[model samples]
Target: MDYIDRAEATRRILAAKERAGLSFEELAQVVGAHEVWVASALLGQNTMSSEQAAAAGKALALDEATVAALSRDAARGSLPAAVPTDPLIYRFHEIVQVYGTTLKAVIEEKFGSGIMSAIDFSMDIDRVDDPRGDRVKVTLNGKFLPYRTW
Candidate 1:
């Protein structure tokens, strides 16, 4: 059998999901993972566990090979350029460009000379209704790792 290409498989999976009108939240429920994580895995940024992959495959009506491919490590960081061209994604980049230093300084002052652990992070996105307009609330929770002096 030919080897499964994860990128291609992810593309196929996304197409099938679209055709089936399955939202990331729906698929995440099937796989028992957060919607953002499920979307990231589908977009080839993260690898899913075998059980999660199988659950996703069943929900998306994907083939066995594609399910197995989902369990493999993704190359990740598949951005076309250093600066993304997409408008929504670019706004995030702009936010970091403007507030990154301020955030770093604040974080350092609060947590000492160390960094937050992305590997041990959790994120939540929520929608809050308002009179003027709805608001998007994003929360990033990461482990505070202190620098060790040898």
Candidate 2:
């Protein structure tokens, strides 16, 4: 089947999602994947399996072209600018800018010269009840890959 571009596919999926009034979590349940992974696949940052694509298509009532697009390998990293313009995204960038070194130092101290593997990562977002206020909790879990030496 001829597939549409990832951006167009994303647009179509988003439109269908809005029409269906489905949250990413709901769609993820239908797709049998984590919400973040499903969302990333729908947004063109990651590829979905054929089964997942079909499930997501059914959930969102998406077209064949969009469904096919979802299974294609993605180019990844769609940030349009060096600094993100979106407030929420920018805040994440800000956090990295501020705490990147600290995190690196801590991680290195704990795990030696290694880096977390985004390729083998899973993330979860949840709400934590707090007396002061409800807090957004994001957990990122990834395998640690120590740098190889010649």
Best model per lDDT? 2
- Runs in model 2 deviating more than 4 A are none
Q: Which residue pairs collide in model 2, if any?
A: none
TM-score of 2: 0.95
Q: lDDT tens string, model 1, 26-117? A: 99999999998888898888899999999998888988888888988877776776899899889888999999999899999999999998
Number of clashes recorded per candidate: 0, 0
C-alpha displacement of 58 in model 2, angstroms? 1.2
lDDT of 1 at 60: 86
Candidate 1 local distance difference test against the native: 0.89
State the displacement of the C-alpha of residue 121, model 1, in Å, after optimal TM-score superposition. Answer: 0.9
Off by over 4 Å in 1: none
**lDDT for model 2:** 0.92
